[model samples]
Target: MTENEREIVRRITDVLEKMASGRKPSRIEYTETDAPDDSTLMELEAKVVELNNLYAESYRFILDLARGKLNGDPPPHNNFVTPFKQLQSELRHLTWQIEQIAAGDLDQMVYFSGDFSRAINQMIDDLREREELRQQLADSNHAKDKLFSIIAHDLRNPFNAIVGFSEMMVQMVNMASPADLKQFAEMIHTSAKQTYNLLLNLLEWSRVQTGRIDVKPMEGDLALLIRTNVNISSITAEPKQIQIYYDGGDSYPVTTDAAIFNTILRNLISNAIKYTPERGEIRISVDTNNRFYYISVHDTGMGMSEEDVQKLFRLDVIHTTNGTNQEKGTGLGLILCKEFVTMLGGDIYVESEKGKGSTFTFSIPK
Candidate 1:
């Protein structure tokens, strides 16, 4: 464009600015008569070109800024709902898997393949191992039931014969000479007593295995229980010349299952008598502290070694050794004692050396 045209446009803008400021220009500035020099014309043209470039760049910048702002905004709520719903569903699925495992469904599996997946797989493996262990326990119990059943059925014959034949033998002995009758009666009595004791142990063990027995805990006199057991066992102890003694501290009252406790006391005392040598003495004692009572039965008997002591209370090991007096036991009595003691929240342990005396200590809550 020529200098004239450039001036006209500039004048036009000045007029508009003055009008916007609410002021009128002193005079009109437009002119078609003055012709600019060559240098002035080129300068005017450069100014026009600069203004056009500035406006075009500014418009492009504003358009790009608007587009950027739109991109920075968050997605629509509807667009987010699906993924959010998916996350909630996954959490619910995990919670259900945990519940199933807690409820003992060992076979259930969680379909996850992350760090949590490894832990879930480990838990399932542990449950499977536990189930296998439970099955093994059931099989062992079944075998025990079968063995006890056989023992129970087989026991009747000897018991019946001993009772029946002994009564007739007594009649025959009474008819015999005085000296002969005394020996026969004594033999019959001894045999009957042995059979009775065996039956008692057998029945008690069976009751314990079947979970039929209920232990009733109460305050009891331990000293009385010991003395009574010693007296009852003397019949078996006397012939072996094994003197049974109760050296327990004064009347000790302990909280325990009375009937079961009595059984434990009787069995231990009789077992001591059964195992001890001639002239050996068995001492029973009760020691007490602040929280518990310790009842120990010590015997100068053919004591067991470490191996026998280890397997002593296990039903499967069957550690049965004949007493010095040839007295026999089913090896169930000690196992029953341990079971009953555990049920009463008590424990039994033995300390012994071969040929040395054995001490069996049991503790009950006071």
Candidate 2:
């Protein structure tokens, strides 16, 4: 064949090889090595340039996908390039799939049929779990903020009352009658008691929140525990002419933490006294079923609305009410009671209507 014909044959052979292998062909470096005419050489040069351009576009497309830049510009869209065109189409689909996942659509599944798909799905699951935990922590932090506010309010009121009453006494002790002195003293004593109870509940609740309160249950007499707390609580109740009764019979036995049980019972009885009218009656009773020991404190007091009952024992939504005689309440006692009761493997509830009365009930294992 002539030199010109040989050059044409060589270029044709190169094109066929590239098509067969489905690989991008590099630039054809045709120069004056044999000096074919300029026009024939230019034709071969254009084909080579086209092939190089196809590979360049394909390279840029893969690079963009790797860098996670899914916006702007696409790959070479020519159908003559088999694998490059196919890859560009698939990458567009992958981008849409990822966008769906980003927009809170976990149900948008990817079925790429390989380890790659499995890895992507696992990543989605991890992201979802992290979001859920983040939300829970936020809610917990919000509740803690409310708790601190209640503490500040409870502490400030009693201290101010004590200080004011003491100041009045210091100034008027010489001129005041015995009746005035005794009244001031009693006021001081009441403020001190409210402050002390708040501190106790605060300390115990802090320990429970930090997961440091350990429960050690033992075989014990429930009747004796109720009687002991009732005696101690009567100190507060006697002043209001309230009568406290406990008929928890001779030997009601249960397995429980004595200290926690005592605190729970004391808080309920104290609350009943606070809400009950003067000369009212509060009866403590104990009953049992096959699974648990049920204890209740029933009172004929000024009860509460259902809305107010729902607000009790929640740190985030606290609504503390004063006693019937305008007595102060710290709001921490019931929260501590709830936590302690839960720790003792029991549940506590109250049945009260606005005009009627209330009965606080709790149950623990036998």
**Number of the predicted model whose TM-score against the real structure is largest:** 2
TM-score of 1: 0.60
Compared with the true structure, the alpha-carbon lDDT of candidate 1 equals: 0.72
C-alpha lDDT (0 to 100) for residue 170 of candidate 2: 97
What is the lDDT of every predicted structure here? 0.72, 0.80
lDDT of 1 by residue, 201-294 (tens): 7788778777899978887877777788778887768788888888886688776788888888888888888888899999988888898788
User: Candidate 2 — which residues are off by over 4 angstroms?
Assistant: 1-136
Query: TM-score of every model?
Result: 0.60, 0.68
TM-score, candidate 2, is 0.68
What's the true lDDT of residue 145 in model 2? 79
Cα lDDT tens digits, model 2, 1-366, are 667757766766766576467564444444433555555655765566566556545655556656765453554465444554455567678778999999988776676757988998998888888888997788578558766776678788888989998999999999999899899888999899888987887788878878889999999998888988888989889989999999778888788999999989999999999999999989999988998888999999988898988988877776888899997785678888888888988898989988678999998888
